[model samples]
Target: MIQTFAFYLFAVFTIASGAITIMARNPVHSVLWLILAFFNAAGLMVLVGAEFIAMLLVIVYVGAVAVLFLFVVMMLDIDFAELRAGFIKNFPLGMALALVLLAELVLGIGAYRAGALELGVPDGTAMAPVGESNIEAIGALMYGRYLFLFEAAGIILLVAMVGAIVLTHRPRTDVRGQNIAKQIARRPDEATVNVKPEIGKGVSL
Candidate 1:
């Protein structure tokens, strides 16, 4: 079926890109591969009937996060030799982390095979109302039950964005900057110099 073929295509690209992302020597190339992985992963999300998640994967991860990573990687002055040295030194730590992740994956798979864990008693309200679409249900729940939390998250992100802008902003003293007040306050006589210069001489600013 077309759906199966599309799923396989997305899965293959996602896995390949993820592997390349890690193996890439250049940080910028790695970021590019990571973006590719995010795109394919988003495609897979779409095939699985989770269009909302797919949208988030594309808009949030690929559009914002991956582009930010690419820009940061491009701007940074990195030393690959030093990075390799650090990687060698931290190889054991990395392996240990990988083992921990592997174990978590195995446990998760086992748990799923056994059946869904009884983590909580589900309330009937969690289910979408009849005749409502998935996105509509999600929107209703988000705006209805978690409105304050959503607003708080927005406020937090706004503050973080403002903080980043403030941190990166540098005041320049060497160049003349626009003075709106000074320009507005000036009269025509003060603003313009009506000088008759010698024919061969250039006028000074």
Candidate 2:
């Protein structure tokens, strides 16, 4: 009973927050709602015995993705009123698309409940023990089975990083960039000066 109640609680919160994420006028508030949805989704995953997925959802999705969204929304200078005006203009089309998506989801759920779209599981297979470590299993799969895909993802992330750097690169006319050759070849004499004191007053002291 307690487990069912908890499941319902998490489910309700997840759905509500997901809706708020899309419907909120403020981008920052939307990001916050998205984070809340992530948290509840993680809880739901935990309840369903997928603790590894739950951890990933909380640690990776919520900690990194949601936080990145919050930071981006907070830092960017966006005119909410202008965005709202544009949204108002496109409201009918957007509403139609949303309704279509909702109908599809409802149909999908109904089909799933009717056993029309059942997934197959291996015979005699069972879930791993609760105390069994996920990191080992994940590492083995990542390094052994999906090594190529992992490397491809790494390359994609590297390219994205390089692109971000290129986008943010700006040439400043006022400030000069360092010249490595000039710095390496610089003479101490050119950089230093010998000072001579005036004779008369110093001698008296």
Candidate 3:
């Protein structure tokens, strides 16, 4: 009843936002629509009893990724016309991919309705108690069963962040840089000259 209504509401918003995310002419608006889609998708996950995943979608995708995307899009001096110049050339490929995805989605839904997938099956005694919070249950599962996978995902994200930084980093040739190796290898004799002067005589430059 209420859950079904909520599910439909989230589904409709998710679909609409996703469409707008692709079709929006403005890149900033596209990102905002993407965030909206992520939020509604998270809501759908919550309705499906996957609250941990829902929170993660909000925290990671909405909080970090979407905001980062918005900031980057705003900061970059991109020419919208140049960016859209290839749309006509790529339209056929995009349409083909969209059709393929639509067919796959329809097949997936049909299979799900026909019970072709053995989803939501409990795995014996490892299930969490009904009264336990989703976060607690997810933490238990992540630490107990999927600790290595979780750590691997963290490592992957760290590597990706490092890669992004490296890709965007540019060294300036105008600025003088310290040569530490040369400094370390230099001898006192090479860096300085000892001088002796007679009484009342000043050193010449």
Candidate 4:
């Protein structure tokens, strides 16, 4: 009873927050609503005994994804009023796309319920003991079966990072950038200037 109640509570909060995320006029407020939705979704995952997924949702999605959205909204010089002015103009097109998506989702669910989808569970007969950690199992599968895909994803992310850096990189002609090679190759005598002063009384200018 407690579990069911908690599930419903989280589900309700998740749906409400999701609605707020889409309907909010302010971008920052929308991001906040999305973060709230992520939190409630994480709670729902926890209710289902998927602690790993719950933690991932909170740590990765909420912490990283939602925070990234918040940062983007904060940093960008967007005219919200001007953007909202076109909302009515785009409402019909947006509503049509939304309805199409809703129809697709409903059809997918109907197909799934009609046994058109074949979902498979892993064979646990030859698995470890019940007391064994799930992390070990996940690690084994990740490193064994999905190693190539994992490495590919890492490389893709690496390329994306380099591309982002290259895209945002601008050379400023006003300020001189450091020359590491020249600095490393420089001698003390080349860098230091010695001034010689005559040790005399200040009698004449």
Candidate 5:
């Protein structure tokens, strides 16, 4: 009964949070909603006996989102005064939400430790040995059966990262760059032109 309730709770929250993430206009708010959605999805994964995948989802995706959130916040031309004011205003609500998520995580871990959740048994052909853990089984499968595919994926990601760096660092000859030495050596007279223009007429370039 408890398991059923928890599953529904996680599922509902995951869907709702995902929707909000898509709809949110503020990038920071969208990232927060995405983090919430990942938390709920992780809970759901735990209930389904895929705790390893859940951990990866949180660690990889949430961690990435946190970095993204930081960059987005830093790059934006935000009003710091308004931001501080909003933070003060929303601090209590944020705390409450954090507490609720923490409580849910605690309860989920407790339930799993107690072996109360059914966590349905695998019915596949590649069941693990009696003493082996699910993680061990997964590792074996990944290393033994899917090693080539995994390596390919790594190579693909490496190529993509290199491509991104190359694109961003490409040289441009048309644009004029700054000359620090020239600026330092320049006389004040060279920096300004005392032009006297006639009334109702523009000065020569």
Candidate 6:
């Protein structure tokens, strides 16, 4: 009974937050709404016996993605009023797309309920050992079966990071930059001069 109530609570909050994420006029408020939706979605996952995925959703989406999104939105200098001025002009097209998506969602849900697709296909992988946690099971599958794919994903992300750095890194020619090679090559004799000055007199360089 408690599980059912919690499920409904999470579901309602998730849907409401999602709607507000789209409808909020302020982008920062939209991001906050998005974070709320993510949190409730994680609660739903926890209720469904997917605690591992729930924790991942909170850690990754809420901790990293949502915070990054909020920072980016706050930092950007955009004329949102000007951007929103065309909302009326685009409303018809946006409504048409929304209707199309709604129709597709309804059709998919109906098909799923009607058992239009066969779901249980057995792949030759060992089931989780008795008394082993779901997290351990998932780890086994990821490290044992999908290790190469996981490594490839890491490589792809690394490449993307390098690409972003290369694209955004601009060298400034307006100011002088430190020359490490020149500094390293300098000898004490070249950098300094032994000077003898008359007593109580200033020395000229």
For every candidate in turn, the CA RMSD to the true structure comes to 3.3, 6.3, 7.4, 5.8, 13.9, 4.9
Candidate 1 per-residue lDDT, tens place, 51-119, comes to 888889989998999999999888889999999899899999999999999999999988978886545
lDDT of every predicted structure (CA atoms): 0.91, 0.89, 0.93, 0.88, 0.88, 0.93
Residue range 4-94, candidate 3, lDDT tens digits: 9999999999999999998998999999999999999999998888988998999999999999999999999988898888887798999
- Residue 22 lDDT in candidate 2: 88
Select the stronger candidate by TM-score from 3 and 5: 3
**Error of model 1, residue 42, in angstroms:** 1.6
Q: In candidate 6, where is summed lDDT lowest over 10 consecutive residues?
A: 117-126
> Can you tell me which runs of candidate 6 are displaced by over 4 Å?
109-116, 120-126, 181-205
lDDT of 1 at 98: 100
**Which sections of candidate 2 miss by over 4 Å?**
106-120, 123-131, 167-170, 180-205
Question: What's the residue-level lDDT of 51 in candidate 3?
Answer: 88
- Greater-lDDT candidate between 2 and 6: 6
TM-score of each: 0.78, 0.71, 0.70, 0.77, 0.57, 0.79
- C-alpha-based local distance difference test score of model 3: 0.93
Candidate 2 accuracy as TM-score? 0.71
Q: Rank all candidate structures by their TM-score, best first, as comma-separated numbers.
A: 6, 1, 4, 2, 3, 5
Supply candidate 5's per-residue lDDT for 156.
100
Give the per-residue lDDT of model 4 (tens digit) for 54-101: 888999999999999999999999998888889988999999999999
Whole-model lDDT for model 5 versus the true structure?
Answer: 0.88
